[model samples]
Target: MTITSPSSEAPDWPQCAHEADGRRCRGRPVEPYAACLAHIGVDRRAGHLAALEPGAGLDLRGTPFTRDLLTELLAALTDPATGRHRLGPADFEEAEFSGDAQFARVDFTGDVSFDGAAFGGGAYFTGARFEADLGFVGATVARNVWLDGVECGGGVCFNKTRIDGELRLETGTITKSAVFRGLVVGGDATFSGIEFIEPAVFMETEINGTAWFDGALFRSDVRFDGARIAGKAWFDGAEFHHDARFDSATLSEDVSFNGTRFVEGAAFPGATIGGDVEFGGNEIGGDVTFRKATFQRTTVLGPLVFPRLLDLSDAEFQSAVTIEAAVGTLHCRRTRWSSTAALRLRHAEVDVSDAVLQFPVSIAGRSHPFVADGRELEVPELSDAPVRVASLRGADAAHLVLTDVDLTGCQFVETVHLDQLRLDGRCPLASPPPGLRRIGRRPVRWTRRRTLAEEHHWRAERQGADGWTRAPGNTDVWGPAALAPVYRQLRKALEDGKDEPGAADFYYGEMEMRRLDPDTPPGERALLALYWAASGYGLRATRALGWLLLAVVATVLAMMLWGLPQDDPEPVSTGTVTGSRVTMTTDKPDPVNPQGSYGSRLSSERFEKSLRVVINSVVFRSSGQELTTAGTYVEMASRVAEPALLGLAVLAVRSRVKR
Candidate 1:
């Protein structure tokens, strides 16, 4: 490729300026208008007369013409006629632009060819309508080119054209096809609102600056193969009726397809993006492919309504990416994902069918937690660091393999399948599924303290006690019963503070006590009685009441008998009768007046009556005396051993007190 010099400094020049005067030329003209006026179509060339024509136009509407006719007509019109030149089927096969020229509003009837033409100035084709076809194959432009509203009945080809300025195709409607294959532009280009009625091609077109296609509508297929865009490209509201191809292209800046709708598939195989790429709020009715593309920064395709596939096979993102609320299949096959900053994936419904998360290894002093569904995760290995998770709320997984996974404070609600080989936490089961097996081959042991409710439940259910003596429950069929010996032993253990409520040691003692003897020791007999009374045992309560009453009465009577000597007289008192002055005395104290002093021996009747009254009031007519202390029981037991001696002692004290 020879490096062409700038147009102004080039030495060889064949140029003709636009005609100003309608008169003849001043110098030696190449072909004078006076001599060529008859041959140049006198009627159509009358309006724009005295102006040098561009070239003869061609027409190939219903006829097949040779290449020589197009060449001859172009040669004849190069002599600078001072009027507009028009060519139809007379010159359709071949045409060239060897010198700098202008052909505004020239018609072409067939496929007009300019295979190797070089233009130094702007190629102005504004409103130059072509009925059949047009071609500027491999044309080169050193400056700007304009094709504003230039309608073509068939495809207009510009396979490789280099334009330095803007190429305007705004409002142009092509009937059959359009091509700008391998066209290179040194400046910006505009194709805004251009309607391609047929298929359009911009295959391998390199734009150095912004390429505007804002509102361009493609009714058929469009191709952009191997193009390199150095600046931002805008496709703000474009609509593609068929597939759009941008295979092997490179975008050095941000590219946007905001609100663009693709009716068919869009492919971008082997493309590289250097900056942020956004496709916000676009709708793709077919599949969109970005296979093997490298994104250097953040890429966003948020809030898109995709009706088909979104493939990102073999694509690498050096930074982060987010594809939020995309309602379609998301395939991220063998892609390297990371972030220079933080990467967040909140509130996105991800459908990972066969995705491989090629998680990058963490550098020194960095943290990375790998989290993906086991079925969706395609990595053959795993990380060794701790995985910090906020919560795993209702995630479904048949197999969860975490090799050396550190979960410091993780809570498990529903039943988690136990691992066959485990380490660090004491799981109750020994073996489970293969996927649940831990990396290490040791048992994981963990001890947890039970809450109050948990302790009560386990004790009443697992270890049966009196507290659980209600109607048998569903679990009580295999559970232990409330036995007295077990209750006593458990209470003793609890009082000694040697056992916690739910410890295994406490339960072991209770189980052992269930086989012990039922007869309690005499010191604990009172405790047994109190227990029966407190629990409202009616039969046991009656028995305990009778024994307690006998014990207390025996204790009080014995104490009173011991207080008197072996010859002690019973207490007595003397009083005067109301009618006669007489001292009344008895051998026993009056039951109602036992606190008075004894006076003298009285009649046998009085003495006998006093003794009977004392006996009835103190012993026979009363319920029983109250036992206030342990000594009272001991005294009563001793009195029961010798009841005859106690009766004699009481009678002697009564006789002595009366005398």
Candidate 2:
């Protein structure tokens, strides 16, 4: 590539101003016009011919035609040497093509238009140059139309034009902008390595075949809003210096933005992609929005770099939504996700806020936790560096709304704003916060604690400002009314997302909420309290085990303090009415039994025996011994409460094991 500053020096010489493959030519001009020998031909004088001349075949093969006729110009040019016509015109409005139209290597120094014309054969404008605007409004090309390597100094409008065959504009350079609004392409339209210096508009255009835009560079904003493509759309390795929007565009086949870089962000809001949509290995400097977009098939989002916010608000996913990215931040408020399929987030480190997610999600085998600065989970080698996040708040989420969305696999590393959240259901929260710092008491001693989460938990669904104390959700103030639905949805989402362990956490949280709710019926609340106190809902078996141990300990202590029961002593051999003062009487005595005297007292031996009874009652077993009414009642209660608690412990263990 030769580096030449054509704009620095004065325009003295009229040379070949044509640029091929991004390099200007040094060919010397052969004419009074600013074109070289190759770019120039016999200068033909003609007024603005508004109508076609009376000829079946108009030949200007080597002649430079600079007329802006409103005639058919999309036809194949008649080979003057062979005197052959490619085809005739169709029954459309406007001028006839006299014959085939060809402008090979021709330099068009003036504006031109052949609006509403129809060509039966084809047209070739390969290596053509237009110093002014070029309009093909409402024209129809029945065959191939080659505009390969064309250069346009001004805008080129193809509005409402229809191309039946391939439309090639590879390596084309447009100085201004290209307008293809309402243009319809019946065949493939290739624009590989094309350059758009200004904003290009393709709004409301329809492409029946594949649309190739590989390596296309857009210096300014580009819009494909409301465009429809029935075939695959490839934008691999494209670069957009400004915002590139495809809002409301419909794609019937797969669409890829692989290796694309957007300096000003890209949007697909309200777009409906029928086939798989992929955005792998892209770089977004600004917000990449998918608001109100719908993906009927699988959508792969990964291996991308986002320096700014990524918004997916109000989007609907009919199938899987796999996100594997290094996003600076993510916003998905009111986004609807598929219940049958998954919303997988693998290895993503996102800073999310004001995100209302009630969709099933999976976060297993994911990268560390998703947390903003000040709320990062403490990985051994991880540092607490502040990362920029562009959400509603300057940093952290303000009011997140997870209304009717399922979020089963995600974790809450940041202190979430529970007050503003609206949770209809929740994912099982097995995820632990990275680390949190909180004020303990007196001198405001900030305590650092890491959440012991190995799974997902929806209550942990917070973004920014770490630690359970600082976390609005960790405040544990949401009443049963709010907590119930939140936990339910979270559990369902986690399950749907295939994060079972995470779902269990939300289940436990739900039961805990139930236990603490004062509005619950006293009986149900009592049971809930028992479950929570004994086992952390049927979700924490350790608590249940501890409750059993504590019960046993209490039973032992009671028996020790209240004294134990003893077996009846063997009767001593009574002497034959030895004396009446003591009223002692003895019967025949055996080795293990003897007739007792009328004198006895409670013994420590009996107290020791009573401890055995206590052990039996604690274990939901029984000691073969007669006891008082109170003791019987105590034994029965132990059989019911203690056994039930033990059962809960077993269930908790089973859940964990299964997970």
Candidate 3:
């Protein structure tokens, strides 16, 4: 087909005006021929080839070549010295090759372009050198395309192309952007040490074999969203200057992003990894998310410096995984770990709310740098913040272990197996509000105790008060009846750990809950109230001793007023003349109860006698003193109640100091 300009006559330096597939040729005409050598008649093509020498510059822009025609052209440019076709400043933009285009080891001393080109068979440019820009935008290769070790001075574009077989561009440097958007390789794709100076785009690309991108440097943003790799992908030691995205991508085999530096953030949300994943030694400057991603094998993600968040919300891990990092936040909400997992973090806030753990999982706070797998991860010096667990609501904690993690704001309501959960080191829980408070002019002092965040929220909501902070994202406030068992189980766990002192606070919390529980029977509730008021459920030594002292004083006063006598009575003899004999009779006046002068009855002498009687009653001994009916009953009651109070005081002391 021929395409001519609008002018009636061809101007000087006339254009070839050749066209095919809706694309017009831009090649210049050959002397003594109307069209360029590629578009000239079959008979004249031999004469043009005779005039061309090896390593000659060739421009066949928009040419449509059959298998025989391309073979003849390449044969004319064959260099005898290296037995390889050599070209200079070659341009095949918008060209169509009807058969296998084999240009292996072809050295182009200047710029080259196969841009918008179509090859019916395999296109080989292996070990070739393009001193300038290399373009293959909108190209289609029916079979494999090899450009392995092909160096380009400028940008490289294979954007929106398809290759039926393997495509390799290993160890090639592109000074500008490396655009491969919407590209598909039916076989293995290899890209190693390809220093992409500008943004690299591989969005919606698919590779059938191992996608190797090891040691690559992307000076700008890179994207790989909607891509699918059938085999393992390695991006070890790769660095991205800006953000990198692999959202919605799928990898069938093991993938490694170790020692990668993402100057900005990196995201892989909704991606699926069929095999193991290794993502250690990374430096991420912004937030990195793997939300909703699925990992089929063991995954290790950390030993890195993450300045911002690492979110794995809704992600699924099928095998064992370990993460050790100094990150800002690690969000694992709704994440499911089918096997064992370990998280050793520093300066990070973790939220595992609604997460499912099928096997044992441990979350620990590291104060200093730790060595893992023979490599020492460096900890940031500016912040020694502990790993704070913000929430564990709805989590199955049957096999969860926490070590030195701060839980001051962690919500534990609806958590499963909370009683069986293991806590090691200083796992700090929230403390009750400080100082005494009043409820409607009644002085109320809460026992200082470590409590859960859910309890705090419940109390605040129940009282409609403001001092207590509510848990984030938690609107369901449990009543004391529901919280009582939670406190009881936690207390039991501490007791089992031989932490009696630590368990003391939990015991107090349990009793408080029981006392406030509306569902408790009246008798039980009243009993709990008395237990608290007397000795704080046998955990308050001072309260028990105070009640004991009050009982002793009241007993002494009762004896002084109603039991001590006014004075001692002496026996007298009386003589009667009833018969001829003199008879002597002895009469002892009964000891009278103290009466009339209240001041005399309350004298120091009477007080001394009353104190002796009261002390004897406390020890369950008889004072051998006379008493009124009321005083007798008072002494009996004091003997039983005072000793019991003393015992409670001693029990409280033991509970506090026990190991």
Could you estimate the TM-score for every candidate? 0.45, 0.57, 0.77
lDDT of 1 by residue, 224-303 (tens): 87888888888888999898888888887787787788889688888888776666556577888888887876565433
Maximum-lDDT candidate: 3
Candidate order by TM-score, decreasing, is: 3, 2, 1
Q: Output the better candidate (1/3) by lDDT.
A: 3
Worst lDDT run of 10 residues, candidate 3, spans 1-10
Q: Is candidate 1 or candidate 3 better by TM-score?
A: 3
In model 3, which regions exceed 4 Å deviation?
1-43, 50-166, 170-177, 181-188, 372-376, 379-382, 436-445, 458-467, 470-482, 492-501, 516-527, 566-591, 595-612, 621-624, 657-659
CA lDDT of each candidate? 0.48, 0.58, 0.80
In Å, residue 347's CA in model 3 sits off its true spot by 3.2
Candidate 3's residue-wise lDDT over 574-609, tens digit each?
A: 877767887889987777777787666788888898
Residue 466 Cα positional deviation in candidate 3, in Å, after optimal superposition: 7.3
lDDT of 2 by residue, 316-416 (tens): 77776666444545565656656333333322233343443344443322334433323432322223322222222211222233322223223333324
* C-alpha lDDT of residue 645 in model 1: 33
